[model samples]
Target: MGNCNSCPSKGNCNSDSGCSGLVPKYGKIKHIIGIISGKGGVGKSTVTGILAVQLRKLGYTVGVLDGDITGPSIPRFFGINDKRSDISQVGDGGEVKFAPVETSMGIKVMSLNLLTEEEEAPVIWRGPVITGVLKQMYSDTEWGELDYLLIDMPPGTGDIALTIMQEVPLEGMVIVSTPQEMVSMIVKKVVIMAKKMNVNIVGVVENMSYVICGKCGEKIRVFSKKTAEEQAEYLGLPLLAEMPINLDLVESMENGNVEDYVSKSEEYEVLLDNFKNKIGI
Candidate 1:
């Protein structure tokens, strides 16, 4: 047998085996894709939920591991609240594991908000503790078998984001951004960070790329800012999808039924198809 300690791949080998903090037994995940952004309010979680639901529609088992410990909205967006992870003994000698809560569409979900008493309660945790929780969500939670696990990552290149990039065996990422150029700078940093971590980027998805006029139905660029196409070109990746601002989606999110929104949106149908082709899913 070749000595893994002396091999030159530097622990980045393409193998099915899991590492120390991540074990295949917890999930045996086929792909781990993160939905990330450069800053907040770009609808990262919205894209995450839409992708998970859409992927499920394509007949693949899916799950979502909310990596945003302090700012967890994946649960709320899916109308999941007041639910805690079920604990069970995995084997002998008192080894316990937390099971991810299943959504209405049977998508496994785990998040800090689900564990907390109140959804509005502040996490108030340090960086390392938060990162530890993110790790435990994968290691300690029983995600079972899934074709794809979409991680709803928090905004910015912070400690938790770095932890996910470094610790999790990310297959690729879907970078979400708005039309603003200021936000593009942060998105560029995220791209650089992903490359540094040796993670493959599936493509970019621009949310709120435009707003449709209620009276005339004319598509209008909200801020007239630089779009994701230019940034994706700069990063040398494809622009997979661009979501326009729609009132129906806004109402769905307000009512905490994002899955229904994704299913009902005709635009999402085409977007999902484009995303699948780009990611080869």
Candidate 2:
């Protein structure tokens, strides 16, 4: 209920701004998942995009909060870039909030990319400042009756990510990882940080776990030998998925449209369906 300074949950919190997101008695959502990665370039935002669409297809109200301050890509991934409304006051002067751009799938999305004029412009914000903005997004936005609020967090266990985990009441988190060995070690840091904050580990999404041969569709393990599955097992977590590398999928995402990027294989579909059920949406 105060400024996020010297809070009890230090390491887990990324920000301690003037955020009362969980204190309000007006309404609340069922699930809030933070899509976090151990490091960068692991397709964490891509996983967030697919998850929102799948939940909407199942007939649920979805909302996404782009928590990555320095690099906010969720809006671009959803084709809502360059769309922003002026901030207006909520009911009874509660807080001045902006309207989230609506995606084709009807998932309400918010990100700094939509607010900014340039997509590639560097956002030089400190850790505490970024954390305060995250609280503003959560408390100020018009996320009414959401079935899920998927937060696209920045890569690594840095200051901002830690602040959000400590201050915000997270329902669960989906850890994104590749099969690389060095990155696997950092993932343990993310897990330990989450545990320290008492946030639930819903599932682990292994992006780029393998590469599928174009002609024969043979699954090729591009990175480390048997490190990904081993990590999940050692952590005693459910292997949510093993996403294979696909170029066409990557190409589709470059334009910020995921409306038609459906997984062709049965295994991918099973993984998608299980994620929805696991989250109970």
Candidate 3:
């Protein structure tokens, strides 16, 4: 109510805000969190997939909204690349609704790739069209009852990111970054944008922070001397997890078996705990 800077209604809203009405009408989504980054190639989608898988592992109903329209990869990661969503008519007005595709682990996923004829097809639409499609995907999808719906945001503070921040009723955001100083610097821009938009940041996850030696079981910080702890301290956010590069996990992702990796990885168990604590769930 202070300035209404972050409100979807902007300058037109009063104390009796109706911002919650902006959310999708068909689902009882308890939490809608965005996984975001300022720079690309920081494994933002990977973090999103991991968080969804971990939340699902705890018997919570979850959904993943692939907001990266141009480079949608959530469906592929969940092994639903070949699957297509079904549409149905609802209500007296006959509103069209989309049914999200379910993974083997029962996590719901909605992505532009799922609706496209080819998985590799490029989304070459303009900014307005892309944002419109994203908004429709969120509001028109029948997500059912979900404990968590993670929005895998596109890289940078572009139109899609700004649109989602303003329109979506996000509970919070999870920032993903890397060990590189340049990457951390770029990620801070996203933090600033989120703060200005009044979006709550849950924490930061450092992906590909280090690698373990296969021969002797030693940690190798090959990417940079700068650590996630330093980056988090600089950004004044909690360091959720310093995720190591595991060839096995990478292979599983490549083969569309992320759920399998989440099921068997002890490291993911720790990450799940950290995420739970940070999100206070």
Candidate 4:
């Protein structure tokens, strides 16, 4: 029998007996990758959006599961915040399934923001409710045939994070952090948690590692340059990419046009290449 750790039955019955129900019945996802961080404001969601767009551009079908239920931003980044997912009944038992909204570039996305009446409304639910919603979003959404499904996880090792690590069949995880020493220090907690859960750590992405001076066109290291490298080495993981603070990209995301940025930006070409190589895509 296969590992029943993620099965809804909690391993009471053998998976070979056809009692397992962990994998989403409606989706054939080739790879499920979680984008996570130890703390907030580390640009984890942005990284997720960029990766989805880049992967789609490479002719691979991709999907984004906004696992950050309380602070869902995947829809906004992909310009699908105003759209609602379509619900339909499927199967002999009449099981309800949600059709994920597609972005301009055709990347499927499912998020709490898409279901809510107002995007600005706060998700006031407690831990259990939030985790339940996350599981439903993963299992109930009709993701179709996808090469990659990226889960933009909430920050920290909390209830939602633990639920995903425990229940979701995550192929790997990409840890996001800034170059600040404090952030790097906190990111170690995430690495430790992933190890404890027996999840593969794909690598670390150092976001906002530097900024470019507009007048001189020089790369300025805002934080210590060695922090991310040192952190990755300490965690025994590869440094996937050192992303600079790009104002244009920020503006693009703010405008809900991340696909445009991915296509037009020459700077992100290196990031895309590095991420693809590290992810083995």
Task: Give the number of the best model, judged by lDDT.
Answer: 3
Give the per-residue lDDT of model 3 (tens digit) for 193-270.
Answer: 999999889999989989999999988998888777887998879988999987888789789887988777889776
**Candidate 1 local lDDT, 29-146, one digit each (tens):** 7778899988999999989998889998878899998988888888877888768877788779886787888988899999988777788999898898888788777777777778
Off by over 4 Å in 2: 1-27, 90-95, 263-267
Q: On a 0 to 1 TM-score scale, where does candidate 4 land against the true structure?
A: 0.89
The parts of candidate 3 lying over 4 Å away from their true place are 1-17, 90-94
Compute the lDDT for candidate 3. Answer: 0.86
Candidate 2 per-residue C-alpha lDDT over 66-131 given as tens digits, one digit per residue, 9 for 90 to 100: 888888888778777767745677689676776777887888887877677788888887777887
Give RMSD to native, each candidate.
4.0, 5.6, 4.2, 3.9
Task: State residue 44's C-alpha deviation in candidate 4, in Å.
Answer: 0.5
Off by over 4 Å in 4: 1-21, 89-95, 225-227
- The local distance difference test score of model 1 is 0.80
State each candidate's clash count: 0, 8, 0, 0
Give the per-residue Cα lDDT of candidate 1 at 261. 68
Q: Candidate 4's residue-wise lDDT over 75-120, tens digit each? A: 8777778899988887789778888999989999999898888999
Task: Tell me the whole-model lDDT of each prediction, alpha carbons only.
Answer: 0.80, 0.74, 0.86, 0.83
The runs of at least 3 residues in candidate 1 whose Cα sits more than 4 Å from the true structure, single-residue gaps closed, are 1-21, 89-95, 225-228
> Which 10 consecutive positions of candidate 4 have the poorest summed lDDT?
1-10
Candidate 2 versus the native: TM-score? 0.85
Span of ten consecutive residues with least summed lDDT in model 1: 1-10
* Count of backbone collisions within predicted model 1: 0
Error of 1 at 252 (Å): 1.5
